[model samples]
Structure formats: C-alpha cells, structure tokens
Target: MSVTQQRFMRRGVTKFLFLKAIADAGNVPLRPELASANATDLSGAISDVAGWSLANSPIDTPDMGSPMTTNIPGEDKADSSSLTFYEDLAAETIETLLTKGVVGFVVIMRKGDVPASKSMDIFPVRVAGRAPAYSAGSDPAKFTVTFAISGEPTLDAAIPASS
Candidate 1:
C-alpha cells in the first residue's frame, strides 16, 4: 500500500468550462481564439476525442501460401464537440449563429486546481433550438440551443479570455 496519495476535489463553484463563439467575415463562430474567452455559466462546451483503431494490411508470406497479417500503426481520429446554451433574448449571439449557420471557433477552458484548456475551430456547425418546455416536472423554462462540431477541430492552439 502506498502511503502518499494526492486527494483533490472541486468543492466550490469554480469548476467550469467556456465556449466562445468565433465569427468570420460572415459572422461565423468557426475559428478558435488564441486565448480563453470570457464565457458565461449558461454556455456548456463539450469536446471529446475519438478512439484510435489499428490499421492492418494483408501481406503474402513466402513460406505460407495464405496471406499474413501485418499490423500498421493506429491512426489518430478527430474530435467531436458540442456546445449547449440557453437562448438569451438580450444577447442574441447564439440565436444569430443558429439562424445564420455560420462558421466559428469554440475555445474551451477547464478550470480546476490545475487548469486544462484547449481550442478547436469548427466549420459548418449545425445549430438547433427546442421549444420552451413547461411541465409539472422540475426543469427550467428556457430555449436551449446546441452547436455540433462538424469539421476538424484544432487542438490547443488558441485560448479564450477567462470570464
């Protein structure tokens, strides 16, 4: 048994992530920023890495008439990311992006005792919204919009401003 162990927990409200919409000349959020952008609590940015698969090819062996298995190095796959937030009538950034279908960058900043961050420029992201659901159940009444990353996302290049 090891005597030393690193124990840590995010007890406060400091644990959070931000996704800053990057816009181009056409006002698209498809480009990532150089630094962490100021993000709001409503903005939920989620990024994931696709698992690598082994690339194999069939090879002919001299001794054996059957084809031999040659294992190639596994290739790295691109990431799939998504951002979700409530529609803000005062600030129509997300609403406009969803309507215009523009390209932009999503900068992600994860804060803990040791902060970890990454950024990705997504293109042709599809934005969709849901109707305000009001029910007897427990849930907030708000229009939610989700942005799906459709293109190759650049990693760790730019950072968003801390909000």
Candidate 2:
C-alpha cells in the first residue's frame, strides 16, 4: 500500500473513504471537536501550517492575490472576484498533538509534481505528555480550555512562539 494510505490506516482515519475522493484537494480532521479547528486550520500549506490558536496567530494571512476580471473595452468593472487560500485541518491536528503531548512529526510528499496530482501529507507522533495522558471516558483530570486534547483531530505541529 502507498505510504499515505498506510499512515491513514494507522491513524484509524480509514473510517471515511470520502477522503480518497478529494485527496489532491487535501485532508480534513476526522474528529474536529477535539482541537476545535476553523478556517485557519484548513488553510493548506506554507503559511506555516499549525493549529488555530489566537494565542499564536493573532492575525489572519494577508491576501495573496486579487481575483481576475474581464472588462469590455472601456467598461469600468466587469465582475469583482477574489481568490483565497487556506490550509486543511490535518496540519492543525498535528500541531495539537505536538503541544499537548511531547510530539514528533513526519512530512510526506510524492515525487514529481508535473502532473499537479502529486502532493504532500503531514502526520504527527503521539507525544508522551508532561502530565499523565488520559484516554477518553477514563475521567482523568481535565485542562481549563473549553477543549482538551481528546477526540479532535490532532496534528504534529506545536503552537508557534509568541512575538
């Protein structure tokens, strides 16, 4: 099996086959509630993929490029359109797994992007938490935030340092 496919199996992400449909577009967290992902999470590669935390990314990524428009001869404006970029929650999950636990990461990619079908996949290593790690339903001590690292999708990335 392919490495990406294998990783998904290991994460128990196989619960959904729909991911295969848009694999190129990117993957989303199977369980979003755990980390509480948002648009910041699914904003895709290179703005430094990380879990959405106001503590770190206080501001959203600035606009990359304006949308294209067609104007007839001397027309003032044809139609206003704008294009935006975003990261998928997978990276966000990895980031969560990293901070809440002493985490590790693996960044995956297929060779030769000439076809544009090729892409990279990121996953996280389960960290040994400084505090004792608790499984769901065990009733261990919980953290303060509205969300605790649990069933939500966790990525290997850690929260960025504060400015």
RMSD of each: 8.0, 18.7
Worst 10 residues of 2 by lDDT: 13-22
Q: RMSD, model 1, all Cα superposed?
A: 8.0
Write model 2 residue lDDT over 89-156, tens digit each, in one string.
Answer: 34444334334434322232322111222233333233333222245785433222111222222233
TM-score of 1: 0.41
Which digits, one per residue and each the tens of the lDDT, describe model 1 over residues 1-163? Answer: 7699756432341222333454454322232332335333323421222221222344433445446544444534333434334445567654554443444443332233132233222233444333343458774434433455545544333333344
Report the Cα lDDT for residue 9, model 2.
28
Q: After superposition, how far is residue 70 of candidate 2 from its true place, in Å?
A: 65
TM-score per candidate, in order?
0.41, 0.16
